[model samples]
Target chain A: MKAPRRGLAALAPFLWLGVFFAFPFLLVAKLSLSDTALAMPPYAPQIDWSKGLAGLAAFVRALDFETYARLVSDRLYISAYLSSLRFAAIGTGILLIVGYPIAYGMARCPPAARRALVMAVILPFWTSFLIRIYAWIAILKPEGLLNAALRALGLPALDILDTDVAVYVGLVYAYLPFMVLPLYAVLERQDHSLLEAAADLGCGPTEAFWRVTFPLSLPGVGAGALLCFIPMVGEFVIPDLLGGSKTLMLGKTIWTEFFANRDWPAASAVAIVLLATLVIPIVLYQRQQARILEAGR
Target chain B: MKRGPSFFNLASVVLGLAFLYLPIVLPVIYSFNASRLVTVWGGFSTRWYAALFQDEQMLDAVGVTLRVGFVSATLATLLGTFAAVALTRSGRFPGRTLFSGMIYAPLVMPEVILGLSLLLLFVAFGLPRGVWTVTVAHATMTLCYAAVVVQARLVGFDRTLEEAALDLGRTPLQAFLEVTLPNIAPAVAAAWMLAFTLSLDDLVIASFTSGPGSTTLPMRIYSQVRLGVSPEINAVSTLLIGLVATGVIAAYLVQQRRRATA
Candidate 1:
């Protein structure tokens, strides 16, 4: 391609992301630094471009880190952040434990069964995420199906709805496909000869798996864990629908702050902090993707 | 040299699949309940589906969702195709790092952060939040997904086919149209489907960016769910699940056919 054409090709998405993707974060940061006002947009120091550089300077002068300070001082905000991290960490651990075996099973299946099994995992992913989480309510509520089933079986009814356990259930249900697919991809490509060699060396099947297969699948584990963990940290629907009101996830906090509280600056501040926590994972994911793409080439 | 699944492996797979499916299955089963109370099965009936179809608000939300999904998915596919091509084919350009970062970042960015930022941007720009605003937001978010999907196809693409087309005196665009486009059409189509579903599935961003009268299906369902899960919502979920499952199966069959032919 010609230089001008190449430049234009790059420029299209570049300009689009600049305006839509990248610029918005700057606006959020600016909003986060601004003081809340009892005004239309509910924040102050609006840039008056009509007054040119003077207005810009005045706007700059009006900005402060007060919202961040409030976020720090407020136990609610701190707990929300910590709770989000905690849920995500525990959820990731459970998903890994649950997902690894399933993925390993699929990877060991016959080629035909493997394809079918993969589709079984992906079909739910194709379904509406909101609907899937909502579905859990039917099974988890006090007078829900679980209790009905328990009654039929003459067992004690379990009350799990509107609790942390329900949130974990939702988290696990929603993110299991993400965890399984990547692990399966990595596991399916392992060299069978390595296992055969290990067997020849008198290693038990389990021992061979831990020493060979499991080590080989760590990249997939990292990819899957990060994929699930990053989103779970900011997950709104799962927690909102399945979690109790007392649940203090940052995503729900941001929503409540923005929509209910009408604290735009505070919401922006929470969002900024949420983004800050995710920067490392996001960067790591990007690098891993680049490496995968490079290796593909 | 392949070994069959062990008993442990078989058991875990069964239980995991059951866990993954039971929540969805319960709702689908309950959607057919004749009773108003969701827990009670008053025999088989489609009254909820009838109620769902007649509900004007539900129908309106569905209409809005379909329109948003179509428009945003198409826009995302175009921009995302451009992005994938540029990221994979073009060597480098100004602000490439930032550009690539923007492309990949949204894939995992928190929906709350994205939605709030875009809402602030719209507020700053004095643009009214409505269907178009929601559409734009969906396009921006989903384009990254589309890009990643299309990029995977593009990276493994045989560039020499396009090179050969260009060597045959075709213009760059012509070569792309004649050779590269057909090769990547399946991936592009898959990307569009993914983007559409994502747009269709989104609740958080739409909840943030949408104005009055621009409520998407997920938003409508969320509101209803918050009120309480009803038979009508169950019916809606079942229909949506059926629709998506159909699309996925059809695509899989087509892909299988294509692979066989190839």
Candidate 2:
């Protein structure tokens, strides 16, 4: 195929992405600058495109930093942002704790059992995310299975259903597959000879893991952390369902502003800041990914 | 591939698998519980399953969800296959970096932002939010997922078969249709399933975009769940879990059979 013609074959998808993905980001940006109104379509200083440049200029002139000012002046949004980051970081940390062993174990399984082991890891991933989160609620509620089992074991029945613990459970459960898959991908491809060499040098198994395997797996850790943390920052359902009254995550904040408060401009402004907060880590992730790919080549 | 890490690996696998499957299996088991409360097991009965069938609203949501999943998955697969082919074939083009970033960005972007932003876009265009809007939104999100999976397959594809087909006097389209398509069909099918699952599983995105008459199964479940966890939801969740588990196992069996034959 002719090069340009072949390139044009890509146009359809490019157009789809442009219209659907990039354009929405643009729309969000524009909406963030507008003011919230009590009217339908809900934002003020609506850009009337029919009036041409003058309309655009008028709209620009009408824009104010009032919504952003509200975001800063109110402690709620600020605390929400910080807490979202905290939740995401803690959730990611727990996922690493929970997922690394599983991935490492799967990676190290004997060749005969390896396929079934990996399949077991991935089976949960194919199930409905919402349903999975829902499944956890029944098990974590006040009179739930865990408490029942705890009582049976003659231990204090912990009440963690509406607490941060529950949210953490939800977040880790939801994002564990994301963490494990990347870790598994990296860990599976590792050279066994490196471990053998480390062992040959008189390092014990634990020492070998710490010195050789752990460092080699850092890329997977980073990738998995990035995968889990980025989405967890704006996670809605997990925190909403499991968190009950306690969790004030940024994603919940955005959802509340738009749906409950009917404050479009405020929601957009909050989203803009959340995006700004994420840009640094996201850029760093992209850079690291690129570097890793280059090194692999 | 393994030698002496026996005890450690075995313990980790058992604990991890238990953690992964317990919540899932419990929900399935409790779907048969005759108790009004979720935790207690009064007795085994299929009453919840019966209630699920009779619940008109839940049935409607199921219909809407399946329609959305089917339509969105098909569109996403079609668009995603083309995008994957282009990434593999067209080496580099203008805006290629931005193009790839867009493809990968959505894979990790928060569903909340993606949903809200797209809702705003729909409102800006004065489009009604309903079944089609939800479908479009879902397709947009899942297309990224589809592209990633299909791209991985295409990247490792052997090219000599297509070259041979071309050398045998087949035209480019003919070579692609006859050889390339067949080779990548498995990946494409896999992509479609992924897209379908993503669409079916979506709650945040669908909630933002769906209007009256377009309530999806997850949306219904979310609303019901917000009130309280009902036995009906457990039954529904069980069925969905069963569907997905069966699909995964069948795919594995197919792969294993292929490996054995080869």
lDDT of each: 0.91, 0.87
lDDT of 1: 0.91
- lDDT, candidate 1, B1-262, per-residue tens: 4489889889888998998898778778888889977667699999999888899999999999999999999999999999998888877677677788899899889899999999999999999999999999999999999999999999999999988998899998888888988999999999999999999999999998999999999999999989987889889989998899889879989998999999
Interface RMSD of 2: 2.1
Off by over 4 Å in 2: A287-297, B260-262
Model 2 lDDT per residue over B46-156, tens place: 999999999999999999999999999999999998888777776678877777777778887888899999999899889999999999999999998898788777767
Every model's DockQ, to 2 decimals? 0.74, 0.66
Per-candidate fnat, comma-separated: 0.78, 0.71
Off by over 4 Å in 1: A1-7
Q: Can you give the TM-score per candidate against the true fold?
A: 0.97, 0.96
For each prediction, how big is the interface RMSD? 1.5, 2.1
Best by TM-score: 1
lDDT for each residue of candidate 1 in A9-91, tens digit (9 for 90 to 100): 66677788889989999999999999889999899989999999999999999999999999999999999999999999999
